[model samples]
Target chain A: MSRWEPDARGRLERAALELYLERGFERTSVAEIAERAGLTERTFFRHYTDKREVLFAGSSALQELLVDTVARAPGPATPMEAVAAALQAAAAVLQERREHARRRHAVITANAELQERELIKLAALAAGLADALRQRGVDDASASLAAEAGIAVFKVAFRRWTEQAGEKDLSEFIGESFAGLKAVTAGT
Target chain B: MSRWEPDARGRLERAALELYLERGFERTSVAEIAERAGLTERTFFRHYTDKREVLFAGSSALQELLVDTVARAPGPATPMEAVAAALQAAAAVLQERREHARRRHAVITANAELQERELIKLAALAAGLADALRQRGVDDASASLAAEAGIAVFKVAFRRWTEQAGEKDLSEFIGESFAGLKAVTAGT
Candidate 1:
């Protein structure tokens, strides 16, 4: 067998999610994940530090996408508009891998520890978005509120997208959720 | 030493926060907390399940206050208005214990693990607020969005209150944050 494996990271992630779903996150082992992927444990370690890391490997990339999108938003865009654009960019990324996202979400929702980790990652994303907004000269409080409100919309929209059975685009849900947020906060 | 102790819970909480701040959360132990409080470890156990619980003992009460406030808002109050009221109620409670809240905030800020726990508690409070909104005849999406937006305002405002040096009231910060949130989301 070649020391270099093709799509090793992707294979390991799929294997890890499948095993986590089949046997639960706590009961699954790194060795089992690697074995299921038909890759050696060393290859698994090369991709992820532990079994849990497999579930969150994309978080950094997602954060970068969100921050970059927010940073690149038009000068005329409001803080909320910049954040909305960022959320739409993130939704586009996830839309391409709906099945994988669904499986991963199921696995995460089943475990309390994973849920806490997910919350932490979401919080980090919000912080990143807030920093990006602040760099645009948005005030501290407004930046933080806009970033957090954007995240809240993303959370609601993502859940709705995952649960509903249809071809409805995640971006549509994002837009709808943002509008819902606006109307509710408008005190109407 | 008498087995019965008055204010045992409060004493344990204060001791735990002091030890956590002095030695860091990872370095602090329940035994040391009890010793610092001049109480038995058994008393500490009776009040809290673990050392971390000391920092979060008020979370349940806070969540109850939030949900109850939302539930009891005047019949004509909008969802956002109800959430605003709940946040003000929560802020008022924290205002009475400013010193303790500040110290606890410092201790949690210094520890990643405790930060995750803090996020989880906030998420739970958001969920409780959403349920209360739903019970008030608010739709599913609106309830969640309002609840989450309220939490976002609370987070930004609470951090400002703790970090700023002034005689300003927390409720004032909460009101300002809600106004900030509305302004940002107004896309102006």
Candidate 2:
């Protein structure tokens, strides 16, 4: 595999997204993306199986970041706190590519298949986070609930961050969304 | 549409589940499902667009149950209370079909396509519940959060209910799961 081609994957992703936007995801071809990225088709194949994967390439990394952060959370911290910390950590990684993320979100939402893939990725991330929490000694039910609620906050906050016109940071949006989850669930 | 075909839909669903389990979802055919249901291919098309829709046939009914329950919740109820009430109400409809729900869940979890469809159904249910909450004067963020949390609780509780050997009712499980969510999210 040409995985060590240094930024080849990133270049292909950028080119694919641009072409997908211009010609629709279905019309965009892997060869065109490779050509646009100034890389051979073989290099593109080494990096991604197909065009759809270019958009989903970051799912595993984000999942690992969330799982690692939750696993390392202080033992005394509440489950929600641990989840909040994990979201903030993930948000920090995402903040650097806000524009790219926004564009990717638009492309995904514009297509049903992409949206399904996105939901599946989020589901996997939640499961990973829950498993990590369980490894940290949290019980099954609590870990699953905390992980799900955290993902819920992440989804809602990410949408808000992508749509907002101001300069608000993704972490702030994540924190506010977590607080909103608490407020919404708080009994009368 | 043969929407008024007496018991045809029910028969098809039962037949579909049996065939899906016996032959596996990928190998199951619409013709076999229609034949097993003692119906013709014509009747099958009258009911469902495809075999996949057989598994998702109940989504619309469930969505309506949730939306209507939320819309009719007590005027002063918190968003979460409204969601909890909605879930309990929906649970009543599901409780009578415990065996069938268990079988359906098994088929869904056994297949990636079915799992994606399940997630899509849950997403649609959340959107419907959120809109219902908004109609009841809940704020946007609160509505979305409560709806997502309700779905999370439902998903976890339903899994527990299905996996348990005892005869506990679905409503009881839902109530317990909602409480578990509160416990999970409670911070120090």
Candidate 3:
């Protein structure tokens, strides 16, 4: 069986996170990560280019969902709504795996280097999102602003979602944050 | 007659930018940068921690100014106004050194690694600004949103300011961007 399967990627991420949590990020090599996952380093490399990448491997999927959703948003969907829809799509994909997401979040927040890489990824994601909006003829400044606003909402809602054990569904929290951002920005 | 004078820092930075533009960041070394400035490498180390830092040595000063402005803002200013005041203060400082600012911008934009470092510093600056607003009794969500919004305006204004060549003032452009942002976020 080839290692280039979606489940294979998920398994590698799970194994890496478990070891990273137990032994920490700096000390855990890819070899150790693969061994713990009952897979080879080659398999691990095929899935993730580096240990730092495991935390971000899903970003590509998220980006694709965001861009595709924004592109197909209904008429009268503003940039923010288009992005909000994308966030809802992502919530559907992520919210079901709550335990895994929480565990990964804990490990990421504890490490500064990982946090920096994560920030960079988010910045890139924001830029990509803005580009998607611009492609829909949203003009440069507005496209950028709306996309950034949406990312800010995503950040806040994601934090809230992860922090609350059972307070609200991810999609619901996202909706609230979207309305909140629009409300906040509305007040001039 | 020593180089440890008040204006010595300016002299060093000038030399560094000139060397970087002439021979590039990698081709230039600390000793060369110092020597070009008519100072010893020891003197350069006294001012800046590293060679790459010469490009970004303004960050801490900007952070301090923004934080102090936010903390001391008049009580009735809305969250956005408080954040905007911090950005206006930064515009004052940055516009004062427009030539050097433009030079550094050109150099940093040309290099990938430097761009990454620049993004990291910008992220930290935004975080520091948000924390400062939060300290001023603003709620976390509002504070972060204001700070992020301020940064968005700054990015747009700074890009416009840096590219202006025909005797344009950065401070004026900053003012315009602030008004534009407020207008877009207004009445909706």
Candidate 4:
């Protein structure tokens, strides 16, 4: 918890989630969260815009990771394949944070306001992915379809992974969920 | 315009959308919406809880229609088939409202807060569809996957339908979108 530590942001996030879970998101204050982390409110503000940001700070990075992967995918890969590959690659960013992700998910799911924010974040991710696809010369409708479907696959897979207690790889679950999506769409 | 008219809700919705589009959602009040509709504030309150609800009043009915269609689909139909059928069936509810739907879509798309609510409604519809599938004996994961994929298709198809100015039926667009989803997932 020293000021020189490299995990200041991570510590703040952990503390914020703990306080939010214990006191309810509406009841938790930034001061209390910072105090719990052995840091000052200024430090909390330095890391996050507000308490809600602690739960959603990864969204921008996740979107960037997805778009970058899609843009760099092999030429032969189809739109969905590119998206799936992007999802697989993005897993690395989340792999080591399984516990943190699960706790964050729980906090978000338990609160209606937080859930709305989560959906908005997911929608933004889909939009960003679609934009990335269009940049790769994919048509708008097809780009949107692939991106939205990829997000749908991610939501289901992430829920399963969190519930499984890190027993399975996030990428493996994403692959399986993508296969499940294919199966459902294939009508068999 | 008469007090005895049966379309109080319709009148209020049209007026509300007009006001929202002109002055923006935040600036539009229920009193202004009601006055624009030639009705009193009580009538507006009677039909919608707030200004935001005016844009989303159809969500519950839309969810019911989807769940019912899925529940009543032929026993031999696959989960995706059931969802596709539900989307087709649900289209009937929206088919005649093309202009209204387009305007509503415009209003929601122009505002971030409304877009969030739209996403929340779609998520709720997905959850309802998954629940209906489970009631028909499908497993949780498969039900959720189909439901979420169906929602993604719906979102894409709806946007296309609105943008196309009703040149084709909503159901047709939905079918084509579902096919596109299948093609994307199939990696072809």
Highest TM-score against the true fold, candidate:
1
Backbone atom clashes (below 3 Å) for every candidate: 0, 0, 0, 0
Top DockQ hit = 1
Cα-based lDDT at residue B15, candidate 1: 89
Off by over 4 Å in 4: A1-6, B1-6
For candidate 3, what is the TM-score?
Answer: 0.91
Better of 3 and 4 by DockQ: 4
Local distance difference test, per candidate?
Answer: 0.93, 0.88, 0.79, 0.87
**Ten residues in sequence with the least summed lDDT for candidate 2 chain A:** A1-10
Ranking by TM-score: 1, 4, 2, 3
lDDT of 2 by residue, A42-92 (tens): 998888888898999888898888888988888898888888888999899
lDDT of 1 at B77: 99
Top-lDDT structure, candidate number? 1
- Which pairs clash in the backbone of model 3? none
Where model 1 places Cα greater than 4 Å from the true spot, the runs are A1-4, B1-4
Q: Least accurate stretch of 10 residues (summed lDDT) in model 1 chain A?
A: A1-10
Per-residue lDDT of candidate 4, residues A1-188 (tens digit): 45575688988888888987787888999999888888889888888898888888888888889999999998888898889888888887788887788888888888999998888888999999999989989888889999998999999989998889448899898988988888888884
Candidate 2 per-residue lDDT over residues B59-124, each given as its tens digit: 889998899998888898999999998899889999999889999989988998889889888988
| TM-score result, candidate 1 | 0.96
